[model samples]
Target: MYIHHSDVQVVFMFTERFIRYIQFEKRYSPHTVSAYQSDLDQFTGFLNNPQKLSPPPPPVITHPSQITHYHIRNWMVELMNQHIIARSINRKIATLRKYFKFLLQEGVIEINPASKINTPKIPKNLPVIVEDVKLTQMLDDNEVFGTDFKGLRDKLVIEMLFGTGMRLSELMGVKDSDINEYEGTIKVLGKRNKERIIPVNNELKLLIAEYQELKKKQDFFGNNSLTLIVTDKGANAYAKLIYLIVQKYLSYISTQNKRSPHVLRHTFATSLLNRGADLNAIKELLGHANLSATQIYTHNSVERLKSIYKQAHPKA
Candidate 1:
C-alpha cells in the first residue's frame, strides 16, 4: 500500500493541534496528555503494521480521516490478543474517541469513526485500604519512622496522603506557600490545574512544621522550586520514591496485596465515610471532579458495616 508524505503530515498536524488544545485550552496534566499521545501513536503503529508475526503487508492508513470503525475494531481485537486488560483497552478507545471527536468538531472529518465503538466492560474491583487502627499505630510508632530528615519526610508523606486524601501528583505539587498554617488548610492543585483547599488537622500542621524545620537543617537545594517534598539530595521528590515510601510503611502494617500511596488515599476516604463524613465533603477534600468518583469509598464502608453486623448480630 502506497502512503503519501502529505497524508502523513496531515495526520501529524491534526494530532499536534489536538495535543495543544488538550494541554493549553483544556488544562490537562502533562501525564494525561502524554497518555493520549501514546494511545494515538499505538493506533497509528497498528494501522501501519497490523500483522507483526504474519508478514503479508498490512493495510496502511496515513490520515486520521481514513480510519474507519472496522480499523478500530481490528486494532482492539489485536490488543486483546496481546493480552492487554479491558481497562487499558477502554482507555485507548477513549483516547481515540476524543481524538475523532476533536477532528469532527474542527470540520476535519464529516463523521467520527470511533463514535460508535463500544468500550469494554471493566471489572469493578474495590480499592485497597489500610485499617485506621493499624495505620494510627504505625504513625505513632517513632521507631518505625525514625527522627532523621528522611524518616520525617517519609512519615509526613504518608500522613499528608492519608490525612488529606490528596493524589500522589497533587501531594508532589504542593509548595510551601500552599500550606496555610493559620487557616489549617493546604491548597492542592489537582487534575487539570484545578485548585482545592483541604483542611489539615492540628497534628498534621505540626508535622508539616517539623518537616519544614528538618528540611531547612539539610543542605536543601530547591531554591526556586517551592515543592514541599524533596529528595535526599534536596531536589524535588519523584513518584517512585514516594511509592517506595508508602509501600515500605504499608507492608509493615497491612498484609494487603496492593500497598501504595493510592491505597492510603483509599484508606483516607473510607475512614471518612465510616465515620459519617458527607460524600460531597470527601469529594472536595480529595479534589475529585465529581461525586461519583468519591462514591466508590462507600462500598468499602458498606463492606465494613456488613462485617461488623455479621460478627455482632444475634442472627448469623
Candidate 2:
C-alpha cells in the first residue's frame, strides 16, 4: 500500500517508525542513526522536489516498491559530479543500502534497487598529520595569562586537545563526571556514542585538577553542568569554539596544512604509531568502527621508511 498525498502524517509517521525500528529492533547504534538520518533526509528531499517527482506528489512513500534503482544511481551521480568527496559519497550509498535492506525484509519492496548500485571508488589521500615539534610548541604556547577568565579557559582548552588527541565532537561532549582523577583517565564518548576511557598525561591531570580548584572557587561546577570544557561564561564548548582555539594555537608553529581538531587526532595516532604503539591499541583509542578505517596510518609508516632510506643510502 503506497502512502497517499492526502495522508501527510502517514509519511512522517512511517519515516519515524522505520528509523526507530532500525535503532531498537535492528540494533543500530546512535552514531549509525545520525549518519542514516543525514542521508535519508537528503534522499527524501530529492524525491519530494517538484522537479524530481511529478506534480501533486504524495507526502510519504508507503510502498518500498515505489523506489527504483534509477533514483539511487542518479543520486550517486549528483554527489560525484557535484564535487562531493568520494568517501562521503560512498558513506551516503552505504546508508541507502542498509535502509533498503530493511525495507526488503519488511516486505515493503519486492527488490532492493539500492543494493544493485555500485559504491563510488574513493581515493586515499595522505592523512593530515602535524609534526611533533610543532605540536609541542603549540601546546606550550599558552603564555597568554591575561587577567580575564577567558584567557585561563583558552589556555586549558589548547592543552586538553594536544594532551588527549580527541575529536572536536568528543571533546565537546565530555562532562565533569566523566573525568576520574583517581584513575587518571577521562571517559570519552566516541563515534556512534561508543564510550572509551583514555588515560591522561601527568601534565593534563595536574592542569585539570588546578582548573577544577579554580572552578570550585568560582562556583562554576554547579549542579546541572553538562559540558566538560566550558566557555568563560561557564557554558559548553561548541565545535566552532574548538576550531577557533586550534587555529589560534596552531598559528604559533610552522604547520604545512590546515590545523583543526581532527588534525590533532591524526597527529596523535601517527605520533603514537611512529613511537611503536600497537596498531590495535591505536584503533581502540581512535574509536574506529573498523580496522580498515584505521589502516590508513600504515601508509604514513611506509612514507617514513622511504624518507629514511633516501637519507641513509650512501650510494644515492
Candidate 3:
C-alpha cells in the first residue's frame, strides 16, 4: 500500500516522455494525442487509488515496470463493471499497449504488461449516411444558404466534406494554396501527417472560388492566415464551428439523428461505392490507412441494392 517518491516521479516522467513521443515523433493528430494521454492518466490514477480494488490488496504499481498482464486484466474488468463500452475500452487497451511498448523499447520495463490483455468485441454498426438525393436536394436549396460570406462558407464547408470526404481535422487544416483550380484536387494533411489528394468536382471548385472571393472582400482577409475556413469575424474556424455548420445545413434535408461532419463523409463514401467506384479508389480518396476501413461502405452499398431489389423484383 506504500510507494516511494522516486517511483512515482519515474512513472510521471516516463508518461510525459511517452506523450511527447506520440505527439511529435509519431505525428499523431492533436485529438488522438490528447485521448491517448487521457487514457494513460486514467490508468495511472486507477493504480494509485488503492481503494478502488476489491478486498484483496493488490500490488502497488509505482513504476511502469511493475505493471503486468494481471493488472491490465483487472483494469479492464473494472472498466467493464463501470459500463464502459467495448470500443472505448479497446481504445484504452490500445493506448496502454502502445505506452508499454514504448516503455519496453526504452528499457524502462523488462516486459510489456498489457501485451496479453484481451479486449471485448465491439458490435459492428454500419456507417450512417444521408441519401444522395436528399443531400443533393439540400445542397441545391438556395434558401438554405445565402450570398453572404457566412452562407457561402457554410455551403462550401458542406460541399468540401461531401465532395472530398476529408476528416474534420483535415478540413480545418485546409489552406487556400491547397486548392488546385486547374487540377481540381485538394491536398489534405491527414492522420499521421500523411498527405493525400482528393479530386473535387467542377461545381465544388467554382463554389470554392466564389467563397474565396467573398472572403477576400472581408477585413479579416488582410490577415496572413492560410487556413481555408474562417469565422464570420475573419478568424480561423474551429471544429465546433464546422460541426454546427454541417449539422445545421443537413437538418434542412435529412431527419437522421446523427448529423455531423462525419455523416457527410460517410455519405461521400457510400455514394461513391454505390455508383460503382472501386474499393481501392474509395480507400485512397478517404485517406484510410487500409482497405479494411474502407470496406464498411460495401455493407451499406449491399443494403441499398437489397432495398432496390425488393422494390423492383416482380418474380416474387
Return the top candidate by lDDT. Answer: 3
Candidate structures ordered by TM-score, highest first: 3, 1, 2
Selected candidate, larger lDDT, 2 vs 3 = 3
**What's the CA error at residue 18 for candidate 2, in Å?**
4.1
Backbone clash total, candidate 3 = 0
| lDDT digits (tens) for residues 66-129 of candidate 1 | 7778778888889999999999999999999999999999999999999889978989888888
Query: How much RMSD separates candidate 3 from the native structure?
Result: 2.4
Local accuracy of candidate 2 as per-residue lDDT tens digits, 204-258:
8887777777776666777356776787667767777888887776766644658
Output candidate 1 Cα RMSD: 2.8
The whole-model lDDT of each prediction reads: 0.86, 0.74, 0.87
Give the Cα-based TM-score of candidate 3 against the true structure.
0.90
TM-score to true structure, per model: 0.89, 0.82, 0.90
Where in model 3 is the C-alpha error above 4 Å?
1-9, 54-60
Runs in model 2 lying further than 4 Å from the true structure: 1-9, 18-35, 50-64, 104-110, 144-148, 254-257
What is the Cα root-mean-square deviation between model 2 and the actual structure? 3.9
lDDT by residue (1-316, candidate 3, tens digit) is 4446776787899999999999889988776888998998888777766766544344555667766676678788889999999999999999999999998899888988787888899999999888889889878888889889899999999999999999999999899999999999999999879999989898999999988988888855688667899998888788889989988988877887999999999999999988899999999999999999999999998998898998999962
Could you list the CA RMSD of all candidates, in the order they appear? 2.8, 3.9, 2.4
